[model samples]
Target: MEVNVIFSAILIFIIVYLLFSLSGILFPIDRTWYASLKKPSWTPSGKTIGIIWAILYALIALSLAIVEYKIGLKNTSITFMLLWVINYLANQAFSFFEFKAKRLDLAFLDTAVVAITTLLLIFATLQYSVLAAILLIPYLIWSTIATLLAWSIYRLNK
Candidate 1:
């Protein structure tokens, strides 16, 4: 595909990803359960949760847009970009299913996928653009910690 077409495709992917991710804010899922769960003592406030995700997703979107604009989505960079899209969508879907369906097992799996794919994105981003890669560091670190949290939730709730 042409670089422009690829960039457009990635843009669409990102928009859809954000729209779906935003669903958590729109609908009140089992936040009560989430709250009551045995979170680490340092668990963030609900407001913090919202703000952090918003900022992270914004960074993610911006990094991707930067990659598309500067790198033109025409080389190995596209592969990295595509991986990020895959993980982004997966993360959204996992979050939705985890909360809406109350399927902790599925949520665990999906969250793990998101974590792993994000790591790949971090690695891939380094080659394409250091700035883009650095932008994802917070997300990667959070997801790594999130992986631990998700597993703990599974054990505590199961």
Candidate 2:
């Protein structure tokens, strides 16, 4: 890849990271409310969640950058772009549902949407760039875990 492509990838990653971070801020978690709920013994600490999400966001940005670079933005199919937008919206909805609204049921639904969109994204990217699809595997796996975790929490608390 060219130096410019690398820079663009990094830039895209940063921008997406910032947008996700903004959701965290807007839907700030209520620590007391969160702690009061019954959680799985294996649930990770706040620091751990932060670290993991940081890594995941970095991967997501890189995957998108790779696809854009390999296929070019103008040439990218409308379906591909739509899938990405859906994924992003669903991702943001999780924070709003779980943290801001304190609605686990809605959060679970949001996570499900995210997982589905992510899978579609993987398949869509594969048609254009295998490397991009490969890069998203971890994200899809993590989203699956997140979806299950949310469901478990909802079940336990309810």
Candidate 3:
């Protein structure tokens, strides 16, 4: 890709991902069922997850910036970044849809989509840059645990 285009894509990815998070800034508190759920002992507190996610998202954005500046935006790299961002956004959307819209089924599906897309991002990342792939490891791991959490919530509240 052209250098300018690559940089543009990177900027767009970061901005879009930030917007996605902002769109659901109140998700944790607004989720009524989330507050009521019997969380697992392994579940991290909302504050902890928030801190982790904030750091992770910032890392992801910076990592992509590194790629854009250093590597000039390979197609594989751009694909990995976009897929990762999309899945992350989708994951947040589930919380809003489930608690606010009261659509457990749709929320379940959205969570499943996030999990699947996360896997895709991991795969795409692994194909080229180890740094990119490594950056997504926590995201993949979290999504796996989140899938289980979502399923548990659906079963418990259904």
Candidate 4:
């Protein structure tokens, strides 16, 4: 509830938003190509995906801020912090692999990595704050689902 936590959350949110946005902007999705993909019937609409990402990004920022506050940003364990950083980078690359590069296999691989990192991030967060760890559960769930979806899409497309 400290001001530092609030400020850190806001700052991290902006940083995440900007960095993620850059991926989308730099390698914009080819709608025509994406539309051609043989997606599963359960695939969510683009709007739904966007909305879910918005919520997940917000939760990610807050969770990270809470963990950082508990552990002290300066004193954080490299391994713990790397979990989130790795997850973010992997996530940002998904668009590149799936949309720009049009590589479903790589996309599926990246999603699996993201899901794995989400688990590590949650476990690492637990050492700092239970609330922080719990906050990341949704992300873990979503990433797992995404990995499955990615695998399905890759298989279907091939």
Best by lDDT: 2
Q: What is the lDDT of residue 157 in candidate 3?
A: 75
Better of 3 and 4 by lDDT: 4
Residue 29 in candidate 4, Cα distance off native in Å: 1.7
| Residue-wise C-alpha lDDT for candidate 1, range 30-144, written one tens digit per residue | 8776766666666667788778877777777766666665555565655776886688677777667667777777777777888889889988877767887888888888777
- What Cα-based lDDT does every candidate model obtain? 0.72, 0.86, 0.69, 0.84
Tens digits of per-residue lDDT for model 2 on 107-153? 98899999999999999999988988998898899899889989999
Q: Rate residue 107 of model 4 by lDDT.
A: 96
TM-score of each: 0.78, 0.92, 0.73, 0.91
Error of 3 at 122 (Å): 1.8
RMSD for all candidates, in order, please. Answer: 4.1, 1.8, 3.9, 2.0
Count of steric clashes across candidates, in order? 0, 0, 0, 0
Ranking by lDDT: 2, 4, 1, 3
Better of 1 and 2 by TM-score: 2
Question: How well is each residue in 1-158 modelled by candidate 4, as lDDT tens digits?
Answer: 68877677667667766765677777787889989999999999988988888888778877876765665666778898788689989999999999888999999999999999999988888878899889889989999999999999999989
Q: What is the lDDT of residue 63 in candidate 4?
A: 80
